[model samples]
Target: MTSLVTDTRVVFSRELRPVLRDPFTVIFSMIQPLFFLGLFAPLLPDSPDGGSPLQWFVPGIIVMSCLFGSSMTGSNLLYEMQTGSHERMLVTPLRRPALLIGRALKEIVPMIAQAALIVAVCIPFGFELHLAGALLGLVILAGFCIGLGALSYTLALASKNKEWMFWTVQQTLLFPLLLLAGVLLPIENGPGWLQALSRINPMTYVVDAERALFNGEVLARGTLEGLVAAVLVGLLGLAAGVRAMRRSD
Candidate 1:
């Protein structure tokens, strides 16, 4: 058990070094989300819950950051595989699961930093900051990011040869997942089919939880649902990631 922790820490720091050197890599990733906040946000009517659009939109953007930031982590692993760097690591004595877990864990720091930056940017524009609830919300986002990151690594391993396959599936699924989760626009009044799909989309629960927490409603029912969904995703991702790591070339 101690060895796993040590191995994971070693791997985590190795993956994180490049990001530390090039901080803007994280900031550049936020460009799209910020654009959505700047342009798309003002077009929406105030939320029915009596909150301003920024209040409603900012939380979703945070989730969007977590989604995009964590999901693309697979590309890094794929590049490493192509360059033989991944094989070098495979020859090390580190436990297989540690590789996946550490890579996934590395996503959390940037995810939280990006979330904080978004909140700071939005607050000046009248986005309310519910400190306690927002802190809790970050916890949920971190868990979700870890799970998503692991799954991304798994996908990269599965597509080590055909890099396009990773991008193809990612591009195909992300928008549907984003739209269906009501990140940019609410789907409450959308068609029955859309609503049905949203109901089953796990990310939808996380979005709902983010909104509720940002509103200072930490005890809201959506919080429980999102926590559950995030945990399940994390467990499933780690499980799959470890399995994939064990089988990697």
Candidate 2:
């Protein structure tokens, strides 16, 4: 058991080092979301019934960071696959599941850092909230991102396609969730059907919860729901990825 944990940590450290080394990725990951928040959040129509676009969009921008992280999940594995490193690793006595889990876990660092920067940028724009809740929101969003990234990695491995599919699917699936999460528009203000759909979207729960946190609205319910959804997504993604790897072996 200790060995498994150690292996997971080793793999996580190996994956995290590259992120730290890549100054460009770090710069863009942390700054781009803030840039979006400043430029696009204001252009959104003023909301009388709902909160400002900054309020609505901040959570989605945070989620957007996660979505982008998901695109890279497969890239590393694909590169290793092409270079024969992945095949060699498969022959080791180390637990393969730990390797995958560790890789996914390490990605949360940058993902959360990116989200934190977005939250920090939001403060100047009048987006305020309890520090405790904001911290909780960041943790929750990071978990969701980690899970989603794992799922995307599994998909990439399964698809065995080019790099474009990773970006394409990440954008296609995650962007719409952000849109529905009341990012550009108020989920409550939408049509009944659309509101219902948003309610079903896991991303919506995170947005709703964060919005409440920002406005000092109680958001225990949304937070719980979002947490559950993120956990499920992560578990399913990890399971699939492990299964695919097993098949390859």
TM-score of each: 0.97, 0.85
Candidate 2 pairs with clashing backbones: none
> Which candidate number would show the highest lDDT if scored against the true structure?
1
Instruction: Give the C-alpha miss distance for residue 193 in model 2, angstroms.
Output: 3.7
| 10 residues in a row with least lDDT, candidate 2 | 23-32
Give the alpha-carbon lDDT of every model. 0.92, 0.70
- 84-103: candidate 1 lDDT, tens digit per residue: 99999999998999999999
lDDT of 2 by residue, 98-212 (tens): 7678877877888767766677767776775567776777777666776776776686676564667666776688567767777666667778999888878777776666666
Backbone clash numbers for all candidates listed:
0, 0
**Candidate 1 lowest-lDDT run of ten:** 46-55
